[model samples]
Target: MKQWLRFLGPLAILAIAAFLLRDKMPFLAEGYQQVLDANNVGLVLALIVTIGSMFAMAEVMRLLLMAGGTKVSLWKTAELTFVANAWSSTFPGGAAISTVYQYQTMRKWDVSVIVSSWFIVVSGVLSTLWLVGLGIVSILFLGASFSIWPLLGSATVMLGIAVLVYLATTHPKATSRIICSEVRTFNRLMRRDPERWIPAIRKHVRQLHAVHLPRRRFALIAALSLANWMLEILGLWLCIWAVTGALPGLERVGENPSFLGVILAFVTAKIVGTAQVTPAGLGPVEAAMTASLVAVGMTASSAFGAVFVYRILAFALMTILGWIIYLISVARGGMKAGEQS
Candidate 1:
């Protein structure tokens, strides 16, 4: 009975929502039909490109592990990436949950705690750097007509943090001393014990010192991270194209939908969704992306339709796939290399 109730709870809410929105049923139906009628080729290409973006990220992770002197296979990393992504996008506090999940899985694969931690931190840094890089390029391509000081400020801040991280990773001893001093000062001000934290910090710093990546490998990882974002952007563009192709007499802002416009929408949606109030920013991300698309000259309905299709592919499908992989991995006794059931 409990299992049945759990399964039916969402259905009941959805049914209630449908009843409440009954008056809008026709409009919703039309949008659904339009999505169904979207260009098949474009839809297929969007799926491919979106999955490619996932693979790109997985490759970054695999490369990071290799740089840390761990030899996890590409396939295992890809599986882990999907599973981690699903966790991150599927629940409240998902990012933390996903990090813990990844760390545990990496440990199971014989990865050192320091190297595993490095992979997570550095991958995130690289991804953010490239996301800001894309935003900057989009602003330039769009003629900088809009006020962009905020974007520039954000870019500068992210770059500064990246440089600091690089320095810390390369000069662990100096970084440790500085960090310890700051911790000691804070502890003294708070009338707390500094000895307890300082030794742990030094130990972690020593572990971190062993997990350095060479410059060339770091650059390759950075490039792969950039590719991951760009491919997802392409997937969004394809979704827009597919929706527009399906909806007859849809009015676009320009001669056609602008790639620059798509980039802006993508960037804006990402920024808004960073809060992750919902799983994968489900509601907020869809709302922000739809609004951003409309601001870029798409009609509200068209924009919503495009965003719906994009999210269906990128978020919904990916989450489902990731869950399936997670279940399979569990049944197979985790993702340990060469360990058979």
Candidate 2:
């Protein structure tokens, strides 16, 4: 049943994408061609920046784990991280895939599951905050408009900050509360005899609370996380620069609420071909983005060239790189195969 769902999910997503794009596809096709034609060798430079900065994300993870007293080397940890990354960007439920795979990989390196979860959770929370910032920046500079979803983005950041404080200061107790609230029912359903699950959970929670991170390490983690965020945004900025000679300011970029609205609509497009799933966010991103542009008092097609090129660099190109890294890991037996565990 699980296997069946996995297969169906992508198919379902693609089918929906096709239905959405049945109308303005020619324009989408034209946009894609325009993007490709506008590309220059400089994109490879952006790719290099993206790839290098992306790898730096691994360093951030390593520092988090180290703070918890797990002594894994940075380079060794990054190798396994590569595979974890590959799965997440390319697969549905990829987040879970990366989580479980990273835990298993770390175990091979003699890292405990508790420590592994800490590293994973920390990296994710920090990374998410960064993503929110990037999203905001993207909007600010976007030649399109996005919905003024109240303080939705701000709320998300604040909640994440609260969670981080909880994790850093009063972790075990807070984490347990969150888990119980979120997953208590799932726990009951998974077993013949439902267990409170607190004692076991508390064990890890206590470990988290007890773990001491030095001030230097904490600062390092914060810095690296910030760097990771800036690098990717810089990559996006560079991509736009490539297509258009000048940069669009924050107000200009944040012009697309429609783009924002339709993102979740076709987000699952990766599995479906662009025609079906619109992997490039082809028609879906464009239409939504165009609507967003109009919302911000911008003109559609006036910046069509910039929008298309930006998507190519930000989404399509990075995903392609992710796939390449995945394939390399698979062929090498395993990322950790030859290395000492």
Candidate 3:
């Protein structure tokens, strides 16, 4: 049964994605047709930029692993990051699956469970923090006089990140105490003995503190994460330019969906899509992005076209590549090599 599920789960996810994307099929076709007709150079640039984001993400993972006392090659880390991200974006409960896969893969490399878990947890938090940072920057660049809501949302995001970073870094012991106590409470409610798990939790917390990243490492991770997001946004920009026949620049501000406006729209749509109610945030993301573009003065057709192109290149293409790499590596005794990574 487990084997069947493991095989069928991805197929099921793909089926669902197809079902959800049916409405956008026409737009996707049109988008591709437009690109071909225009013979746009921007599309190629966009692809390169989007692919670069994956490399940047891999670096972030490699650095985190190194901090945990394991040194993995850049290519190996990149492969794992790509596969894990693809799995997370493709399946229901993908985030959990991705975490488990990453943990197991790292364990194969002889990384301790505690370090693996820490990397997973800390990296997730850091990534989210940077995403929030991007959203906030977008809101700011779009100008506060434009919308009160996004400004407020950005402020809230900033505050949340500050609190989380503070708790995780400056107050690790206190944070651990709170988590341990909460676990004990939950265990009591479930009629399970808290003693069995409490000690383990404390030990893990101590290990996390011992391996806590220094300021320089933290800055490097933040920069890489931010660059990854920026590259993705740039890809969206190039897509819009490919369809509209005008590459909007930051200096060309003054309304009518300027470059900053497009970026703001992209950031807004991404936040909405982060809910991930659909696989890889497909339906909600497209809808949000299309709406945002139209609101910023793009024609509905152009908005849809640009968004479809960006999604195809950034999300779908990456997933396909990741799957290919995963399959090839698995056949090449990659599981054992993962440890040496």
Candidate 4:
């Protein structure tokens, strides 16, 4: 009963959200029609680039696993990527749920807990660093008068995390001792047995010492991560082109929307979407990206149309495909070797 409730909870919330936003459905439908009326070539190109973005992300995961001394194939990583993305983007608290799902799935691939944890952490850190890099680039390109303090603060936090990870990996014994001590104190406060968790913590910490990221591998992973973001941005640019071509009036608003404008809008949408107040940051991301596009001189309708098309490819289409992959994997008995594992 509890399992059923857990699965149904997010669906109920999503349905309610749809109900509350029912009035906007027609507006969104109109945007969808505009996209369909646009040049088919641009739509196809946007889809191809969006897919390439996902593939790049999967490659990053595969490389991170390799850095952790695991040899999972790209196809397997890609499968996990799509499935995990479905979990992360569609449910309440989806990001955390997706992390847990990926960890468990990797365990089935014979990945050790430590290596899997390392891959998750390192990949996340790399992604954050690159996102900040994008923000920096956008600011430079657009010369927008936005404050830089937030970006600096984010960079500082990432640096601190990187330093701590480095210390933990290089000085495993000391880190283990510190962690176990904290665990013992917490267990005592909770009237629990330290013996239950300390051994596991110590073992995992010890395994961290074996995780070494080579410079070349790290560079490649960084490049892939960057490529992933770039391709998504390119997809958005293509969507804008499609919308402008379809609606000639949009040309009056902005003759040639600069690529830098799209970058600015993409970064803004990403930052706003981190709130995750809605499933996959649905409402806030669309609002932010559309507003940003309008701020960059696009007509509101055209901006909304482009954003709608981009979301269809990036969020809706990908989510549907991911769920299909997830169901197929389950039907095949959970990603085993010789299947889509």
Best model number under lDDT: 4
lDDT of 4 by residue, 1-341 (tens): 45335444554665576456646765545555676687788989999999899899999988777666677778778888888887878865679989999999988887789888878887888788788888888777777777878987997898788778768877899999999999999998999987669888998998886677777877898899999999999999899888878332222334445777788889889988887766678777888998888877776667878987898788878887888898898998887522225
Q: Which candidate has the top score in TM-score?
A: 1
lDDT of 4: 0.79
What's the lDDT for residue 149 in model 2?
55
TM-score of 4: 0.83
Q: Provide the TM-score for each candidate, comma-separated.
A: 0.85, 0.63, 0.78, 0.83
Q: Over the stretch 239-274, how does candidate 2's per-residue lDDT look in tens digits?
A: 545554434453334532233322221222221322
lDDT of 1 by residue, 1-341 (tens): 54334323543564476457747655445555668889989999999999999999998988888776677777888898899988887775578989999999989888887678878877887788777777777777766455677777877887887788778878889989999999999998999987658988888777766665888988888888989998999999888789877321223355255777788789888987888776777667877887777776777667767888998899878877898898898898888753212
> What range of 10 consecutive residues in model 2 has the weakest lDDT sum?
264-273
Output candidate 3 Cα RMSD: 5.1
Give the lDDT of residue 257 in candidate 4.
58
Ranking by TM-score: 1, 4, 3, 2
Instruction: lDDT for model 3, please.
Output: 0.74
- Clash statistics: count for each candidate: 0, 21, 2, 0
**Residues forming the 10-long window of minimal summed lDDT in candidate 1:** 246-255
List per-prediction Cα lDDT, in the order shown: 0.78, 0.55, 0.74, 0.79
**TM-score of candidate 2 against the unseen true structure:** 0.63
- Point out where model 2 deviates above 4 Å: 1-33, 39-41, 133-203, 249-317, 337-341
| Per-prediction CA RMSD (Å) | 4.1, 7.3, 5.1, 4.8
Scored against the true structure, residue 2 in model 3 reaches a CA lDDT of 55
